[model samples]
Target: MSQNRRDPEQVVAAARKGAAEAQRQQIEIIKQFAAIDCGTGDEEGNARVVEIIDRQLKLIKGIEITHHYAEGYGIHIVARLKPEKPEGKILLSAHTDTVFHRGDTAAYPYHEDGDTAYGLGIVDCKGGILVAIHAVRIMQEADMLPNKEIVFIFNCDEETGTPNGHAVFDTEIPGAEMAFVFEPSRDEDGVLTARKGACSITVEVFGKKAHSGVNYLDGRSATVELGHMLVRLYENNDNVRGIQFNPAALYGGDYGTGIVSDHATAKVGVRVACQADIDKVKEIIARVEKETYIEGTKTEIRIDRISVPMERNEKNVQLYETVHKAGLLLGKDLPEQASGGSGDASYFSYRGVPAVDALGPYMYKIHSTDESMRLSSFEEKTALFAVVLGIL
Candidate 1:
């Protein structure tokens, strides 16, 4: 990498000094986002988050704002800061929603104790949004805004990968050269280099219904067929290839006991390491679909959603090196790792854009009640991210 105009250490020191004054405001903003109670379906909470961020984005002069909606979700907030004489373009992304329900914040209200912030969405994304926004805002205060047009995207449905996450490629990535994503870090402050691809599948089975003890022979139990299909799915799961087929939910039958049900449904979550393996997993499901575990049972299948794999491509390797160099300048040795889970980074890389994932705060046990943001690590991320912006 060629030497950038700015010195990383001096730029970071100035940012840290500026951050020291506004650390309290950052905490307050995080609390505001966490207390909103935005889960997958809570439109009220989702809209509230947009409102809060909209107000913040408006403070930056010459910023253009717009919105994009995810399928069944509320919105994806987009903001751009274009200089009159700009160098190029950079895209920064983070999600606005969390995995907890609307009332989750009441049980786990936003509270901080010394080096940590505790709340429902504190680590998974609220904290990330805070870091990403403030990383630029603080740099701007130090007159250190990146020498590129910056686009900030806060999508609503990353926890449950939705239309907004993938929809961004068309609406948000135009003319942008690089994308930086802010999901939480993992395994002692590591950066994500690669991630698995996923496809959501649904299987439904139909059977004849009849009375239990009276006409048991006439009844072809859909429940029984589902049991056999579930086993076949399990058997087809390939461990060596890191392919997982999990039957997450099952629905069928009726409230009354003895009556055989005619309809049955199952939702399966599939994760694969490569995009090509999606077909392999599908063939496994197809093979099971053809099997007739029950004489009168019929089945239907649908692939609900799919995102191409975030394999470690050439762009990804180069981006990791850039982040690694930025970390070294800030006195942080950021390790790199591959994840089985999916993130917004996958979509960007699939579009042939070099993207970096997991640039948010450091925390453990995300998507759980125990989620907490380490204040110390949060400060480190703020500093390193500011330097990364300078170099990139």
Candidate 2:
């Protein structure tokens, strides 16, 4: 039963069968995963997740598992499965960390009601992790696994933009033909063809402090300067299509109401569609920084944790078409859409790896207590992923 001699329809049918058989077990696995609180920077919790995944991957016989750890970030696991007959290389990635806190899971554990499963990070990525793992397992059990070198990465820090796991991707992404990121599909089961680039900009304004009543005219208020800057920053949002500047958090002034504030700080979240958009954002930030709402006030800006956009390119569209064909095989129409959210997919797609995202379950309200994934989508997406791997 050589791969070339096998019928594509038969392979897809086998994937669907395997997916159906594993549906219940997959749900249980997600429950197990959701019980652990692997929030970003929770080293112990994230390590526990790594151990679970590592132990499971070891049972599969030929997977070469490597654990990468950074000082502040938890472990990142890279599991490679090389086929007997290698056709090409494929990369699969999912994040282990969520945006919730350590006790959030204890307060809101995984629960299933009818066809929806709810938890803190269940859909945001725990479900996605199961999809990546079980999709490979289903293909293997069906004897329909493709003759491609499969590299799967379960990263620990995606909610914070993968500052630690980017190093692993830097090494693993090259030479890979296509990448699938398990980042939970849109509520309507839409896969992401494009995602906005993101960065955090922190602005600090400094001015001289003085008594508000006695030295009102002489004193420069940093708080007033930051207030003006925030308004200008918000104006950048939608100024150009697909570009946004959000002043997410602001801190300024002491509790003393009688004193003019000497310092103010603003944390802005910037999202852009392309390099040109990023450049435009920088220009706007500079303009805001230079304008003086209050005399003698100086501003300093720091931009860090930048992630590039996942552009909708031809290769990405081709990969989406492959997934779409797989969906049709399962009698599902998985629409392709663009997302303002950023993920690990952007890393590969930005580097020309032909990446597609949201290959995970169909879920909504991720990063919140209302986070839930459709129970049926687990089987459906797993089957779709397995079929895509087989046909590729």
Candidate 3:
């Protein structure tokens, strides 16, 4: 009874019935949101988003709403859309924070031309939120909404790897059968099947400082040792192993010239494709700390913020079938592919939920002033999403 192998023509056609006009009207949602500056940790900008979401959700009927917040992070809004008594739970994961700084919106206002809308976070997520909002509204009007506990989890600080939002997910992400994340499609028509996980590894070296001209032989240069250690860390970046290590920041020596450095620190970004690779990378980090290039230097390694890899698995393949069938109904190719970027959705994948991402729009330039997204995919992707409720 699955449409996984069904012909494209056999797909249903519901959203396209009037998808264009509906999207044209609702497109304003993204524009209005894009104009507001909601950078990571921007209180005023995030507050503006809270106001907008609060106003819009108020228009919908019969939905349970809850607010979760982090002390310094923004807010996480969860809304359950269904009858008081629902059939099942399907979680929709998304975020409201953008990488745009304050006043960036003022310089680059939301602009649209020839089916493309350019603005900060437009393709990254504001457009994604718009599609979901319109999908719910249109489905409500057509009386096609199924009796399912469709929970919409929108959190702040996703731009910063959901640091504070983890509290929000711990409270809500459980019990969901699956999670569909809207992170912008891999391409014009590609949905994500897998994504790399990331972590930060910080290594510090402590060395004895001595006069460069007089007691140089007794002194050990931590900076020189760090340089050798960097080579070892970067050697772990093996394409075959699906792991990448990049030295992001390096600080060595303190103050002026003619002095042996006492301290050196190297901050590296580690990305892994799977848990095996994650372990391998961790081992590599440990190995580097044990071997010191400088004789007198002591090395310390600290690895933090390990994210879950959304690896392509059998469960995700089945998930792709369901979403592909929904896409078929919309008469579009819904192919699945791997992505290199990590996101908050990693948590759900980490928590044992079959999750897929890149469900937003078709756009490339993200986190920059030239950011833009295809308008047509908004209608197309939303159309497919509108049908997912019935199928799930």
lDDT of each: 0.80, 0.85, 0.77
Runs of candidate 2 exceeding 4 Å displacement: 1-4
* Worst ten in a row by lDDT for model 3: 1-10
* Highest TM-score scorer: 2
In the range 306-376, model 1's lDDT, one tens digit per residue, is 86788887778888888898888777798888888888888888887888888888876788987888877
lDDT of 3 by residue, 1-392 (tens): 22344333322344555455567755777788888988889877887887787666655577677888666766788887867676666778788999988899999998989888888887788777766766776666655666667788888888878888877777766667788888887565777868888888888888888899999889988888888888888776787776878888889877556888989998888787889888888788888889878788999888877877788887777887888878766666688888788887677877878888878888868888999888888888777777775455
Clash counts for the predictions, in order: 0, 0, 0
For candidate 1, the TM-score is: 0.94
Query: Which ranges in model 1 have alpha carbons more than 4 Å from their true place?
Result: 1-3, 69-72
> Model 1, poorest ten-residue lDDT window?
1-10
Q: Per-residue error at 31 for model 2, in Å? A: 1.3
- Tell me how far the alpha carbon of residue 28 in candidate 2 is from the true structure, in angstroms, after superposition: 1.2
Descending-TM-score candidate ranking? 2, 1, 3
Q: Please, what is the TM-score per model?
A: 0.94, 0.96, 0.93
State candidate 2's TM-score.
Answer: 0.96
Best-performing candidate as measured by lDDT: 2
